[model samples]
Target: MTSTSTSPSAKFLTAQRSELLSRRESYLADMARSTATALELTEDGANQDMADEDGFGEGDTLNVERDRLLVVASEAKERVAEIDAALARVDAGTYGACEACGKPIPEARLEVVPEATLCVNCKTGASLRRK
Candidate 1:
């Protein structure tokens, strides 16, 4: 394999790293906003009021909406962590290498999931093993 700095794949990986960093920032911001909103609602006793009014349809709706936002925030937080790991891999010169088999992960797969640590075949095999 060529030195990472001289490889064509290095350019693509560099771009991916930039994109991932931007996405991580967005996810962090979203998580922060969501958490703040949730905390504010909690402090204002909105959840308590909604719970007490559960007999009414409005409370149920509010509860469902709150749950959805929380879920979104949780997912964003998870993605941010994944992006962090991906960045680490990029810095370590292993961003596009499969962790399981040491093969080059396909560009298509990396485009869709830059945090992936396995090539398609290895990933499939691992999944099958799990079953």
Candidate 2:
């Protein structure tokens, strides 16, 4: 879907693109940090002697933290992918249109979520369907 007269302005699109790029960079950095922390936790756990008095509980705690960090990294990676897709849409001249309904997404919504691909109604329906 392409933008219409009522769609976001060129300036708005440019700003959104810049914002998306910045967010993508941030997300990538977050992913790297989280992954590194998870790796460090894994290595630390591996080096600890299993026969220590408190080793079992400490290892379990480290494992939980490592798992949480992994999840954070994965979520950041997904956000980066979404930002990339939004940048592609900006380049393709479809940045402000809903991908599912081909409607002009409200500027307010775009302002809040530049990477959104669907209008609020479509997104709500999709979310419901997912459940």
**Candidate closest to the true structure, highest lDDT:** 2
**lDDT, residue 97, model 1:** 80
Candidate 2 residue pairs in backbone clash: none
**Model 2 residue 36 lDDT score:** 100
Tell me each candidate's TM-score: 0.74, 0.91
The runs of at least 3 residues in candidate 2 whose Cα sits more than 4 Å from the true structure, single-residue gaps closed, are: 1-3, 49-54
**Residues 1-131, model 2: lDDT tens digits:** 68557568888998898889889989999999999999999988987745575698888999999999999999999999999999998898878888888988998898899899999999999999999
Model 1 is weakest, by summed lDDT over 10 consecutive residues, at 1-10
What is the C-alpha lDDT profile of model 1 across 65-128, one tens digit per residue? 6677788899998998888998998888778888888878877888888778798999999999
Q: What local distance difference test score does each model get?
A: 0.78, 0.90
Residue 37, model 2: lDDT of 98
